[model samples]
Target: MMSILGLLELNFSFQLVSFPAVILKRLTFHPDDCFEVRTPNLASLGQEEPWTPNTLSLRLDLSDPSDPNVSISLYFDPGTRPLGLLPGSKILLHNVEHKISKRKNVYCRFINTSVLTVISFPPSLQKRITTDETSFTRLYLRDIRGSVQGMQQAVCSITRISRLTLRWNCIWCGKLFTKGRCAARQEGFCSSDCGRFGASASVVVDDGTAESLALVEAQQVAVMLGLTAAEWKVLKDEVWMRGELEYSYNQQFHDPVADPLWNVVAALCCKASSFRRFNLSFCLKKQLHHQDVSEKTFQLGEMRYATQLLSSPVLFVKNITPSDWKALVSHWQHLHEAEQSTH
Candidate 1:
């Protein structure tokens, strides 16, 4: 406990590394198949020394008695973390054989203490969970070996607590991560802002509006880039909230409504182009790498002709010859005038 408080006060941090060694000793209670561990010798606490035990404890003790007032206790299950110990390391131990007879079970007596400076995961070739892969927790275990000699209880005494807080961390990013904001919110990103890259990504969205918008925009962008419905669907739900479109439309009707008007204008514009006769060959010869020609890539072939007129997009100014814009407006005006005459 003294050691822990001192560590907290000093803001001590250690570099953890894994190395292969041996468990010199271990004591298992055959009835429950659990083990108890303690410092095996005094000479083993050297820097970079590995920890070995005849019996490994389910808990570890890390209190110091040099000063008596401030101390701390931490409890952990076996296989909770990879096992390695360097000089200055602490361990919490529990004696399961000496539980008190009461409505509640209480642990007592000191087994041993290890003088490891650090603990860390052991190296393995198996790839850990990464963000690019499917999001889920996969099980893993690492073999660790280190040597440390624990001191006697008279040197430092620590009382065990009923429970300890365990941190849940991101499997990929290795930071504190959690779920549940309010009762109303659904789970995914820790918060809505994180979903949108807005703030620090800590607030949760109770309503699904933000999520729905993101999904729709991803789908629309997929369409504009010539993606199939199935292909778009595969990536639809994987976008951020801020990237969503500002408007909403019925998915069933959107395709039918937007296609015709765009097609007519695009066809007229393309026909007016010097390259109209080469349209089929031009499309076929378009650089596939540069072309958004997926099976469902947006069918905006007509608009392609019109966009070609715009230049200096940075200036928001049309780069086409004045005659081209004038012709387009005049053509629209003529259509309007003809419709009025018919009416």
Candidate 2:
């Protein structure tokens, strides 16, 4: 009898009030959950309105006839994505009405649906991305944490603190190197020679016409300055002849042998912004003048004497056919000792 009475009471309560069933599919958002609603009766509630033009609004319908306030929560997945649902968007809604009339009976009803906008990250495939450093770094971190924990353990045996030094390995040539000036200074490219690119014949120019000859000579000078042979030959015969009249017969009209090409070579090798300073300094030094000074006064000139240039160890190093850089080192060593003895 008591169970029957309880069932009847539940039925009566359900008939007066009902909750809408909610289903979340392919869940993306998780933070935006709580929702609130208030109505005098169910007949006054309305359907939901769209939140943004890009987003669809969610709606919840109530089954109760009583005008009661409601508060609810919802959930979805949260992962980072470029577009679609972000961290903070909103929800929209209005009211609805239902009516029933007949010859023998009359009734009125209120109904409504609430609108909700999604706010959270969506799952993506980028989570699987890995790099070598990151992977090794994670392993290192794990081992370090374990080691620290072991050191802190009360029952663990204490070992003498031996200072193990740091070390690194080169990525390119696969060589082990100790922690020192070479490893700390360079980015694991064991030596400058290892990173140096081999010299190749870069550009070929026409050899027939007088103008072609001039262009070739210009290109040869530029090659001495470290411009690629192909690049120096880019200004062809016709262009050279067009500007040829500006040069004079007495001018010698060769690329400046006045300065060691090392300055030009290093200037071009460095960054673009610093190029202007080099250009201005080269221009002010009268690099194009080609005037000859006596060999006796060569060492006394403003560092541009042709013999001084010809004697430069850089020229001796680059122009020779020797396979070893040690030959150049040997030549400089003799020259340095000679200079010291004279002094």
Alpha carbon RMSD to native, model 1: 33.2
- Where is the poorest 10-residue window by lDDT in model 2? 205-214
- List model 1 lDDT by residue over 1-343, tens digit each: 2233434332333211111122222222222445443443223222211322213343433334344344432333332122332213332321212233264433222322211222222122112222221222222111110111121000000011111112333344333333412212244533322221111101010010010001112222232223467844433232121122111111221253645432332232222221110000000111112222223122222422111211100001111111222232233344445556787
User: Per-candidate TM vs. native?
Assistant: 0.17, 0.14
- Top model number, lDDT: 1
Judged by whole-model lDDT over C-alpha atoms, candidate 1 comes out at 0.24
Model 2 regions more than 4 Å off: 1-219, 241-327, 330-343
Candidate 1: Cα lDDT at 318: 12
Q: Model 2: how far is 296 from its true place, Å?
A: 9.6
Could you tell me how far off, in angstroms, the CA of residue 28 lies in candidate 2 after the best superposition?
64
Candidate 1 lDDT trough over 10 residues, lowest sum: 204-213
